[model samples]
Target: MNFDEQTVLVTGAGRGLGTSIARAFAHQGARVVVNYRASAVSAEQLAAEIGGLAVQADITVAEEMDALFTAAEQHFGTTVTTVVNNALADFSFNGDARSKADSISWEQFDAQFQGTVRGALTTTQRALPGMRTAGFGRIINVGTNLFQNPVVPYHDYTASKAALLSLTRTLAADLGVDGITVNMVSGGLLRTTDASAATPEAVFDLIAASTPLQRVVTPAEFADALLFFASPWSRSVTGQNLVVDGGLVKD
Candidate 1:
């Protein structure tokens, strides 16, 4: 389907990478729904700037997620045809602060699971009916390259994202028959996002030096990959994880 005809919902879109993703879709002429668990002020500003809608909803909660979709449909007068599972629990990319393999707790793992896997699950389930009815849909889950590289070995975060990738492929397999496509966009340490803001300057330099592109990937760059998945150009490209880390992890 054309982007102009699609209603795109981006979770956690009030700030950070979600903000960039929302703007990118809006620039493409899509009716964007900026979903945020918090950051209402920033979200509302973004929505106004793009002439889109801003709705608050915690993606892990089914009831709130349902409301989110309902609000989008009511405002746009069309069901959401694209979903970007970009919301994550509060997290920082500071290697020194992360729990090591021997010290990580199950609670930490569970928390990440709730945000990463469960959030995606709820959003996907809620969006399926509309997508099936339209005979076209795009489900793009934001992931991390750490699953393949494990540069910092963020055990909890990496593990949960790995599971998200698994879910991405499995959903693509199951939903393909219904004319819905599911995929993932995995990125390395982004230049400047809320999650990556905790990263020290040296770490960013180190990552930039390691990648073939010789620079850290920007949130805008990562978000552009998401557009491909939602656009007709990628109709046949489902169940794949496109790594946008400038050749940092060539999987």
Candidate 2:
């Protein structure tokens, strides 16, 4: 996990899981670009603390994504060796039961899909060339294990993550020849994050008791799977989804 001189660009790095991932890369000695759509203050604070650069960009916008990469090259004087797509629309953080397939509106589904799939697609498209030139790259998409076993009805979110896994596999097939590997790490419900704050304590307790680890995974624990995909150890692996749900979704 030592990335002494590598440069990594992480989206949605202002807080939560993104922030933790950024810190992990920095801890491994990689120069990191912390990208955020808003929350300039927190993003900047994280960048300063990690000795990284904070670049503001809306992942759904191609121009802004281009600017983020340009700034990364300008600051680090090298192409980014790793790109982690962790950004998504600022939707309801709570995993409240949403629309059912029969009742869900197209707009709701589209809004989530655009952020998860389209945003990741565009960002990777922009970064692939640089990755090709460098002859190495790691592209890890943050996914959720909820899609595999949907205990809660998060129609839009679950659909988008499933789509993301498809994108990951396809991209890996298209880019593996160039040394750019695409992969995904899907995790079960996490505690304390805004996304999980609304989950009922009783439900959390039930799942934890049933799960092999007997607890929800933390952001740090989830990030460890991401790090494995980015590390040299996974060089031969690509287009695969690794479940980090403490055996909750064991295949």
Candidate 3:
């Protein structure tokens, strides 16, 4: 896929999946804005490696989010056509799975949702104006396949992803007329730098065994699905969730 001169903003690109996604776009010739909250060093290194711009901002805060877009416009000339909402707070790998729903506090759930869903909401809203002005936009939200099969019962994380899927479909309907397409790419049990560290080897083996492809998906693999949605080939597609879980949740 030749992005050529297109600009894509990837949030949380300091490391792991977000980094991979940013690099993928950069490799395809799209000017990428690598967004990070605290991992400035890593973000800068990646930006240098890919010849992209690194912007720092906490998406949960409105002011910081505004700064993020401002920097992107300054670097890319005010016409960002793609956004990949890959930023999420430190919710996964918290090791806080209690059997009973009563054990899950409201604060825990809210924090999880606020980081993932709320952050995506704010980032997308901030980018909508530029996207509308450009008359072409692709909004890809990174989600988890845990919603299909909650083996470990991460209530807060799972619930937030479900909400994100719903948000994707709704946004696709609302934004289609504006030449903006909203979609999601859901992955299962990806072994990464920080997110899925707590997952045990046996659990991974079992999931891989169950999957038709007999393997867990990687960040790069999932990024391919995200690229498809962002490319012109998917211009007619929107409001869809493409699961890249090796056939683990094919229902």
User: Best candidate, TM-score-wise?
Assistant: 1
> Which 10-residue window of candidate 2 scores lowest in summed lDDT?
90-99
Question: What Cα-based lDDT does every candidate model obtain?
Answer: 0.95, 0.87, 0.86
Candidate 2 runs further than 4 Å off: 93-97
In order of lDDT, best first, we have 1, 2, 3
Per-residue alpha-carbon lDDT of model 3 for 1-251, expressed as tens digits?
24875789999999889999998999888999999988999999999999999999888788998988888888777567889999877855533444358677888789889988889999999889988988888999998888888867888888998999999999999999999999999988886647777666787788889989888888888787788988879989999988888898885
User: Sorted by TM-score, highest first, which candidate order results?
Assistant: 1, 2, 3
lDDT of 2: 0.87
| Clash pairs, model 3 backbone | none
The lDDT of model 1 is 0.95
Evaluate residue 102 in candidate 1 and report its C-alpha lDDT on the 0 to 100 scale.
87
Ten residues in a row with the worst lDDT in model 3?
91-100
Query: Top lDDT: which candidate number?
Result: 1
State the lDDT of candidate 2 residue by residue for 1-251, as single tens digits: 24875788899999878988899888888899999987799999999999999999999899998999999999999998899999877665454565667888989989999999999998998998898898898999999887889877788888999999999999999998999899999988876565577677887787788788899888888877788888888989999999987788876
Give the range of the ten consecutive residues with the poorest summed lDDT in model 1: 96-105
Task: Supply the TM-score for candidate 3.
Answer: 0.95
Q: Which has the higher lDDT value, candidate number 1 or candidate number 2?
A: 1
